[model samples]
Target chain A: MSRQTDSQSTTKTRPVPPTLSVITEGSPLSFVNPDGTLTADGEAHGIDIELTRGLYREMLLARTLDREALSLQRQGELNLWLMCLGQEAAQIGSVAALLPSDMIFPSYREHAVALYRGVTPAELLVQWRGLAHSGWDPRKYNLQMAALVLGTHTLHATGYAVGARMEQTDEVVAAYFGDGATSQGDVNEAFNWASAGSLPVLFICQNNQWAISTPTSVQSGGQIFRRAAAFGMPTWFVDGNDVLAVHAATTAAAAHIRLNGGPALIEAETYRMAGHSSSDDPTRYRSDEELESWARRDPLTRIEKLLRLMETPESFFAELDESAERLGAEVRDACRNLEPTELADLFGNVYAEPHDSLEAERRSYQESARALAGVNR
Target chain B: MSTMSLVGALNAGLRKSMADDDRVILMGEDIGTLGGVFRVTAGLREEFGADRVVDTPLAESGIVGTAIGLALRGYRPVCEIQFDGFVYPAFDQIVSQLAKFRARSGGRVSLPIVIRIPVGGGIGAVEHHSESNESYFAHTAGLRVVSCATPDDAFHMIQQAIQSDDPVIFYEPKRRYWDKGEVLDQSDRNLHEARVLREGSDCTLVAHGPTVATALAAALAAAEDGFSVGVVDLRTISPLDLSTLEEQTMTSGRVVVVHEASTFLGIGAEIAAAISESCFYSLRSPVLRVGAFNMPYPPAKVEDAFLPSVDRVLAAVDHAMNY
Candidate 1:
């Protein structure tokens, strides 16, 4: 293996793009307008309306869950909560376009993606509540556990995609990360491996502009989508606030990845209207005026306007509102009814086989706790 | 029966495994055309086309990361990490991803990836070259760590590790790669069990990897002095064969652990603690450990002094006997 092969290509440098663009421009993909109305031509399309409605419903459900989770945190129930407040369109739309056969490796902030994949809202809450690692089974939904580490999951997703190619499975893998993760070494390594191996993976960067206090300009000096082109991957950018645009771009990119046995990139250029999480106070870093500007392009409001302009019956809007209320109430009930998990479960699943050392440690802890309880009694 | 060195046995085992299963593929730096730095993967690239034996870039993370993907794709990828010290860059992939994938998938996916690394000291290697870091992988959940001390063990264990559905971290003794022994045509051996290389009743000397050969040599040296010492080779490091250990220690009534890694938080520390808990009453003397001191591996000239040689094992055994 030490012999240098002339067949290996020397590293080549490519031109970088100044700005991101893919499905945001004028096209049959645009279902909603900036004025919150469906264009005259948009009203004629039935698939666009249905997909927009689905995105709106999922977003509403996610928002309600977000609110309830925040309440739980404030009430001293959860250890922490990372709210997916304003990037619901990027999550829901991209996930909706993915076939069930495709595997998704998500960062911790993908509440809407988890919901779309049918993970019970309560299950997602339990993890933040400090009761479990991840609430749902990954196999049942073809989703891996939410990785808390920033860009590490990207490498895992790339490895899995390579595995898929070796197995000759036509399935694609999607790894979701934020713009802030672009700075991590693992993300760049993932790009290199996926490109070198030609793994079937879709790298979706939810460019919500801010990673905590750090802005996108600080995270990357150039466009994130163009970063993929240098790796020989086809890249796409979507107005992540627009559900229809996101769906179109992700669907197209995913198809390209599946057909070409190589990685593709999708930069969902969205904005976070709310603070990063309940623990964060964006007032310290961002201006209210800037927040309001992005909120004006609210994904839900845009789609709702389009539905109304399509002359979709008032009954449809009423049903959706009612369903949102039901979902909110259901989340509330589930949170209130969540049972406390055993402390032993933490050590139990750590290893598949019984580890005598861990077991001994657990027993010692139990004994100490019992002794303290006995003394108190 | 055929006599072969540890490296030669590993090569034969790999060839047999590749011949047995088309899904078994080898990937690592210098594993293909160069047959690895130690020639453990010698002739594999020529026999099995480049597809089955891949020469990866000089990226350890990439090798392990891609192996995970290859495993997901239903290919049994055996990754070589070149050296024990070089495995840190891939620690995230092995511990975080490789070890957790099967459990994270909730049994929906099984990762049959094997990572082989040349470990331990005594060949006068430089820094970041000689390390017994099996404890790190053994402590991690969803991984099986094992080391072979003899040619016969190497011949059998490699095939056993490949057949396992779980991920296995296979540590090869780089220093003992050329040490030869007679390897039988058949090895109907259990990979999870410990082997009693040299039996005695006075005290037991436990070791694995390069240290196992050293402990065996010490046992031989002890026999000349009319001292009866039991020598046990711990094949499985993760799920340690404590059953055999407890049985041997109870009969021997004393024990000494040996390894090349720093003593603190090393495999010896874990084994000593486990033995104390399990065979507390059976112990005639406190469990003693003979391992590298808690420090960075010394320079090549001082490596022979840093590693646990037969003299160090005998010294530890003498100290235990005095107690």
Candidate 2:
């Protein structure tokens, strides 16, 4: 039997960081520069003007919901909330580049992807409200529920692509994860499995600098994208904060897989502008200098600058601001009004088939509850 | 009815399932060209083609993790874990991902995936190859854990496990893989129900997987000594057929649970506790459990002493009857 061999070099080379935020040797691929001007590569990509405007609108809507969800967490309406405060461009741009039928597997922090995929504010907040383990139907949105267990969902995405291959579909399967998740063994295994099988799965690692308190410098030995090359996977490093760059890269990556090119990986260099979650305190671990630098390159702000430079109608900004407020209000209302999952409903879905022990326990619990209610009466 | 070995029965069952459903595919390490280490999946790749039977990279997590994705894509995947101890690497995916996918998705998504692991001691194999790890999966919610002791049960149970809408942890007894028995063309009972191999009024010996044959042997030896002992093959470990167990326990009035796993917190403990609660009045003695010591599976040379033997089972029966 012939072994699956890779033509890629096995010799390892140390990747020097170009800057504190970037992990690779070269500057990250960017379209919109920090100064609100398109880079030469960005101009050459020729992204549609309307798509750029839509990216800004989507990023703003995601930011609005994220801010309201964080505030609601502070007020104790939510049990917890992981802010996607910085990685909006990586989420919005990549998801927008995909076909609506393309499947997505997200690792918890992709609220932007969820909202872009048509998950309602109520459905998104229900999980954080401690009402349901998962809030939305995966089939309905073609987006899987948030996998809180780090990089595990990447394998599911690969396996889904394996199925897609048998069906001979042109659909691309995508998995969204963070740099911290790259440390997991499952993540590396997913990369190898997908590469070996030539599965049509795109691994988008939003290298958001910090995994809780652990920085990317200490978290990885070499560049995250460089690790994919060892698995013979096509690798791309992009400025995650640049929505235009991200959309273009993902569009090309998805097309490559659709054309039967093997699995690919895109390491999106971005920063976590907020704490890990409502529970984390980023101030203790990171610097004010770092925070200020990332704030200047904020995903929403970068696109808004480009929109202003393009002389977009002021009414477009006015209407979007009002829409953002409405989205925030909707999220706040959804978080507050979300119903708690009932005890009777809890055991219903544990198994698709009837389980004798679970059924018996449910009956016994109901009987005792009824007896206790009678006593209270 | 066809007579075949337990492993042959499983192979036939898997072939039938694949022939029956186009979505049924096999995934594991060495499952395709190698036909698996045990040869249970032999001749399947050639018959069904390489697409249906896959030989994956030597990663247990990769086998199960991708199976989860395939399940999400509307394919029923049967993942082979290679060995009992090797399953721990994929433990997170099975319990966290595959087991919880249905409930976590609020019943909207169900992973009809079967994780097949060859379980128990007495194989005289090296470390990590022979171990009884059923209790770990049975303890988990949202997973259906089952073990088939005979060729007849293996034939039907493997098919039933594949048909289940819920994710199943199917335990194939490696030591008994070559043991032969007659298998009917169709199943006579539900997948989860226990089977009474023999009826006795004095005591009942309960076992599953590799230990079922041992319990049957112990029952025959007990008959020589004038002690009538019944044997109950617990086909399903989780969501145990408690009614069948209680009914059989009532007949004997004395019960001894047996397994190759450590007695402490093994399936024996659960059976003992449940039978104690249900058959408290009828029981002549407290439920006794005969199993390996609560430690790592000993070396192959001493595995006979480590695994539950007929003498050890008879001793437990004698202890239960003494009361």
C-alpha RMSD by candidate, in order: 7.6, 6.4
Query: Scored by CA lDDT, what does every candidate get?
Result: 0.81, 0.88
Candidate number achieving the greatest DockQ relative to the actual structure: 2
Quality of model 1 by C-alpha lDDT: 0.81
User: iRMS values in order, in angstroms?
Assistant: 3.2, 0.7
For model 1, the TM-score of its B chain against the native B chain is 0.98
Alpha-carbon TM-score of each model against the true structure: 0.87, 0.96
lDDT of 1 at A373: 89
- Can you write out model 2's per-residue Cα lDDT over B1-323, one digit (the tens) per residue? 99999999999999999999989999998999999999999999999999999999999998999999999888999999899999999999999999988888888888899999999878789999999988889999999999999999999999999999999999999999999999999887999999999999999999999999999999999999999999999999987998888998889999999999999999889998998888899999999999989899889999998898999999999999898
Error of 2 at B312 (Å): 0.7
Kept native contacts, as fractions per model, are 0.38, 0.92
Give Cα distance to truth, residue A74, candidate 2, Å. 1.1
- Over 4 Å off in model 1, which ranges? A1-33, A37-47, A76-78, A344-348, A353-377, B19-23, B45-51, B72-75, B101-110, B278-284
